[model samples]
Target: MRDFRDAKAMAQTLRDALKAKSISVSHSESLELVAKTLGFHDWNVLSAAIQSSQPAAAKSPPALSFNGGTVIPVAPMRDIVFFPQLISPMFVGREKTRRAVESAAANDGRIVVITQRRAEDDDPDFDALYSVGVVADIMNRVELPNGNQKVRVSCGKRVAVVRPAEADFLAAEVVPLEEVRALDTQAFALTSEIFEAYRSSTNTVPPQSLYRYAGEPGVLADVVVQLLEIGVEKMQQALEIRDVVARLETILGWMRAGAPAKAS
Candidate 1:
C-alpha cells in the first residue's frame, strides 16, 4: 500500500527498469506515466497530493483568515519584502509603525506589511506603498530603550491592498492573493539546483530549514527568495510572481546571473 510520498521513488525505479530494457523516456514523461499508473490524472495532481500529505510540521502555514474584516493595520517596509512562511524580524521606530504593530499584537496578532516604493519615504501613505504585500502573524514583540520595537513575524499569505483606511497607523483593506502553483519534474529539478546553489553560496540559512519544504515547491521558492540578498525591487518581483515554476525559474536565473544569493 504505497502513498503519494513514494510516488517519486516509484517513478525513478520505473525509469531505471525501462532504461535497462533499452526503452528511453524523459524524466517528466516517466513521472507522468507513474502518476497515471497510480490513478492520478497527471503529475501535477500527484504532486499536489504529495504536498497535501506532508507532515503538519513540514507543510506551509494555512491561508490567512480575517473574520473581522479585510482592513488590517499596514506596516510599510523600508527595504525588505516579506514572503509567506518565512519568519523574519522587523524594527519599528516610527510613531505610526509602532502603533500598527501594537494594534495588531494587542488584537489578533495579524497585520498587513507592504514595502514602500522608496525606502526614504519615512511617512509613506498607503498609495505610496506597493499594492502587493503579505499578511503576517506577530510572533513576538520587544520594546527597545531607544523608543523602537523589535518584532518578529511569520508571514502567512500574499495580499493586495484594496484601499486605504483612516487609522492611527497606515491601514488597508486587502484581499488574499492566491498562488498559481504548477509543479512538474522541471520544478522539482529547479528546487534541487537552488538547494545546491544556496549551499555553495551562503551559510546563513541552515540546510534543514530549506530542505524541509521539498514537497511544497511554492513554499520552497518563497523560502529561497527570502534568503536572497537581492534588492527590494527584485524581491518585489519575486513576491508578485504567482506561478511556482516561474518563480523557481526566476530565482535560479538570478542565481546563475550572479544576482547575489546570500541573505542580508
Candidate 2:
C-alpha cells in the first residue's frame, strides 16, 4: 500500500534511525538517500511523482467564449499538436513552460497549448508557434525531481492566438474557433468506416468505446487520427481544419497512404 507519497514520512523515519545510531545526516540528505533507496534519482523526482499522484480538487472547465478578449497563459509544445476532445499528458521541462503551467494551475487550469514550428527552438517567439492550437484545461500537474513538471490536460476547443503578451510567462489573447458541424449521410458513413479502419490498424478491442464520438465528426476526426501512425505535421493539419467533413476526408487520405507508424 506504500508508494512514493510515503517518501517524506519514510525519510523522517530514516533520519530518526540514523540519529539513534549516532549518525548525523541533514534532513535534506536523508530525503535524498531515501529517494535513492526508492529507486528514484533524487528527492525531487520522487516528490514530483508523489505530488502528481495526489487527487486534484474537482473543478469545471473555464467558461470561455470566442469573444477575442479571452487571455490565458500560453505553453509551447515541442513535439505534439493537441486537438479538441483529446486528453493528453506531457512533460514540462522548459522554465518558461513550467512557469506557464504553474500560472494556469494557480488559476482556472485554462491555458492555450501551441505547438512550436521546430522542436529545436528553446526560446521561440510568437511567430515560431502555430497560430491555431487547442484551448485546454490542465487536469493535473506535478513537479518532477529533474527540474521538470508533468502535466495532464483535457483539450477543450480550437482557438486562434490573436497576439502574444510580454510577461513572466507567455500570455496570449485568443478567440475560440467554432467547429463547422456539417454532418451528413456521407460524413456519417465515412466516420464509421474510419473508426473501423482505426480499430483494424491499431487492433484495439471494444471498438464500441469510441462509439461515443461517432455522432460528432470534428471530434471523431481529432480523436481517431491521434491513434494512427501520423506525423505531428499531419496532426497539426487536422487541428487546423475547421470543417468536419473535410477533416474526416483528410484523415482518411492519411490512412490510405499508409502513414509511418509513430515511434513507440
The clash number for model 1 is 0
lDDT of 2 by residue, 1-264 (tens): 877678888889888999999998998799889888987645544653454344544322324643334458999998888888778788888888888888888878898998999999999877788778888899998778997888999998887665566678888876556666557677788887786566555556425656888887777788777777677788888887776887899898787677642322
* Candidate 1 local lDDT, 1-264, one digit each (tens): 767679888889999999999999988789889988987645655664565456768866646554323459989999888888878899999999998988898888899988999999989996588778888999999889997889999888887665577888888766566676546777787888888777667655546867889878888888888777788998998887767888999998887777666553
Best lDDT among the predictions, by candidate number: 1
Residue 141 in model 1: lDDT: 90
Q: Show where candidate 2 strays beyond 4 Å.
A: 1-63, 66-70, 199-206, 260-264
Root-mean-square deviation per candidate = 12.4, 21.8
Residue 21 lDDT in candidate 1: 98
**Candidate lDDT values, in order:** 0.80, 0.76
